[model samples]
Target: MALNDESLQELKAELLDELVKEVPSKTLLSLRLAETRSADIGEILEEMIEDDEELPAALSLLDILSAERAANVLGYLPGESQLEVVGKLDDSQVLKLLEEMGSDERADLFNLLSEDRREALLRRMAHREREDLKRLASYEEGTAGAIMTSDYVSIASGMTVSQAMMRVRQTAPDAETVYQLYILDSDGQLIGTMSLRQLMVARPGAIVDDIMIKDVISTRVDDAQEDVARIVAKYDLLALPVIDVDDRMVGIVTHDDAMDVAESEATEDFHKGMSIGQLEDGVSRVRLWSLYRKRVTWLVLLVFANLFSGAGIAYFEETIAAQVALVFFYRY
Candidate 1:
């Protein structure tokens, strides 16, 4: 079952009780967190890190988890929180966590590091992983490539159903979603797509090209992330394939990631509607001065606008004097 807000709060309270002990028991902490979800864990960590007194406990809690689990939970943290966690870890330790993260998320965390730290980490990484990180990080922010993950399953054209099934089994472990698969040619260009259900029901000896849908709906790498989210929602796709200028399959923007973009965009629009500037963090976590700065500009302008009303009223003083009842009606 999904955890509601109350349950999350309860979990955070219990964890905090354990974390604040003089010498927290690692074994007990591990068992307590064993069944918790990554997103939930991230939320708890965010709360802990937001308090200066509990920062050490938060770091200790992260250290107790295995590297892969830590990386998974770290992906759910906001940018500021993510940096705070990474700031406490050494270069090698941070690299280990980065290795376990998904391609897109890894690139994001890498991009957040300072120039010297990024150079240090990049130097220690393997050739292939390093190249992939640089390529993924090279994309402009707010673009499709920036949010897309290279971890997707792709079947080659002309492969038999039996062969394709075997490939799926091999790659699905790392893929963002195996429900939708792209079919590519020898030149590494996407030519078609097929659902996992379609492949399962087809004859083992049949060619994938014969069964795959030739006309695939896809987006370009340089497209706006907002447009990508719209396309995902419009077609109700589980994942949208992203291609480069050469028509080569680069990565995919999973539905969850696209929805994140949509929600963020909606929040930004809401802020604009209220005449508030974009906030870098959630309202509760944002600094008081930042909140004031975002609000004061619009408020000052509206104050000036209200002064015009007083000027008009002054000009109509004689008219109001003739009709005394109209003075009260001006409040409307």
Candidate 2:
């Protein structure tokens, strides 16, 4: 059963009780979490890891999950929590998790590792995987390429409907979304697109070239993530194809990823509106000193500006003595 807020809290308490014991029951813990959602499990783990003593318990909980489930849950965790968990694991264990993770998420976690650790992990990866990780991680942090995943279905420009369906079947299992399919030329440049439904209903012998939509909606690799999110939302696209200057397909930003970008952009704008500087993490996770530093500058300026009002009031003391009512109607 899906856990509600109250049930999640109850589960947290029960898990903590079990975890604090000298001999924790892994079987019981597994049963408790068996039906819980990965996202909720991540939240419970995050709260547990906040206390240094509870970290081992958190790690144990993660261990109880299958690699794929653990990777999915890890993706839901805050950056710091993710770092903490991975720091406790060996290279091979982390690599296994990375293999199960989505391409974009794997790149993100890789980017968060320290320089030496990154090198160590890179050396262990196969050639194709290592190159892909480096390419994905090389994009500027706020660009489309940074958020996109290379897991997308693409068909050759000249394939028949039957061949396109076969290609879809082979690639769809690994694709972020199979609703939309890209058609690429011999040179790997994106030329057209079609939906899975369109291909399925077409005559088996029909040429994909004749059935595909000639114009494809796509974004550049260097495009701002905010802009990519906007395009995805505006078009109601399941995924927006990301390309390079030469129009070659590189990756696709899925709708969920785009929504994350939109939410982050909105948060940044909200912070700016409140005269607060950008925060690297959520407000609750930021250090006290950093929070003070972000807020103090504008607050100090406002304090000094208030002094001018005091000065003006002093300047008008005699006038106020003659007309006390003027103070009540003061505009400044």
Candidate 3:
């Protein structure tokens, strides 16, 4: 059932009460929590921390969730809360949570951490994950590489439907999404795409290339996330492949991630429209100077532009006085 505001608040209170109990109603709570949305659960944790009360209870909430789900909820929390909640957890806890986080999300969170904390956390992650994290985190913010996840389903174009299906099955567990599959050449270049539905219905003996759509919509890793989102939205794609300078496939930005990019871009535009600086973090958490830095340039430019216009008018005042009679007939 869809929960109203009052019901959601009650659910949050119930969870907080359960979490704060001496023994903790872990089992009973899980049964109830399973019915709640991750967004709502995140909201509960956020509500509990508005006054910074019940942090331990919030930690308990995080603990009850599996690593992946915890990461999902963590992504929903504000940056400061994310750091605070992670600070309460041990390194092992943090490691497990980060391991299960999406590649893009892990990079975003890792970028926010202190150097010492970053190194410590990186040390605990497996080698593959650590390497992937570095590669993704190295990309400039707002770029496709920074937002794309490396965990995508890729299949050889020559593989038969059966073989491709087997590969999809094997990769699904680790893939961020398998609903849309990329077809790659031997050199790891994305050549086309095939939907999971099409793959399933194709003849078992049919080659993947025969069924794959050759006109794939994609973006470069260095392209802006906004550009990637636009391509996905225009093409009604579930995912957009990321290619390198050499046209080799490296990752994909899933539809959900694209939607997030779209929202962020729209919000940024709104902020700019209001003449407020677009903040990377929420308004509550940004430093006074940081806000000033982002806003001052635009204000200063506007001031100078107006000053130039005023000066030009002042300089033309004598001419205007002489032409006062002409002003009335200056329609042309």
Best by TM-score: 1
Q: Write the per-residue lDDT of candidate 1 for residues 1-332, one digit (tens) a residue.
A: 56788998898888778888888888988997888888889989998899899899899899999999999999999888999999999999999999999999999999999999999999999999999999999999999999999999999999999999999999999888999999999999999999999999999999999999999999999999999999999999999999999999999999999999999999899878877767777676678888888899888988988898888789899999999899889867
For candidate 2, write residues 177-267 as lDDT tens digits.
9999999999999999999999999999999999999988999999999999999999999999999999899999999999999998888
- Please report, in order, the local distance difference test score of every candidate based on alpha carbons: 0.93, 0.91, 0.86
**What lDDT does candidate 3 reach at residue 129?**
86
Tens digit of per-residue lDDT, candidate 3, span 1-332? 77787998888888877887889888998888888888888877876665567777888888888888889888888777788887777888888888888778888888888899999988887898889999988999889999899999999979999999999999999899999999999999998998999999999999999889999888999999889999999989888899999999989999999999899889888778867767766567678888787788888999998899678667877887888774455323
Steric overlap count per candidate = 0, 0, 0
Off by over 4 Å in 2: 20-25, 280-293, 313-332
To one decimal, what is the Cα RMSD in angstroms of model 1 from the true structure?
2.8
TM-score of each: 0.92, 0.90, 0.83
Model 3 ranges with Cα > 4 A deviation:
279-332
Clashing pairs in 1: none
The alpha-carbon lDDT assigned to residue 1 of candidate 3 equals 74
C-alpha RMSD of each candidate structure in angstroms = 2.8, 2.9, 4.3
All candidates in order of lDDT, best leading: 1, 2, 3
| Model 2 lowest lDDT segment of ten | 274-283
1 versus 2: better TM-score goes to: 1
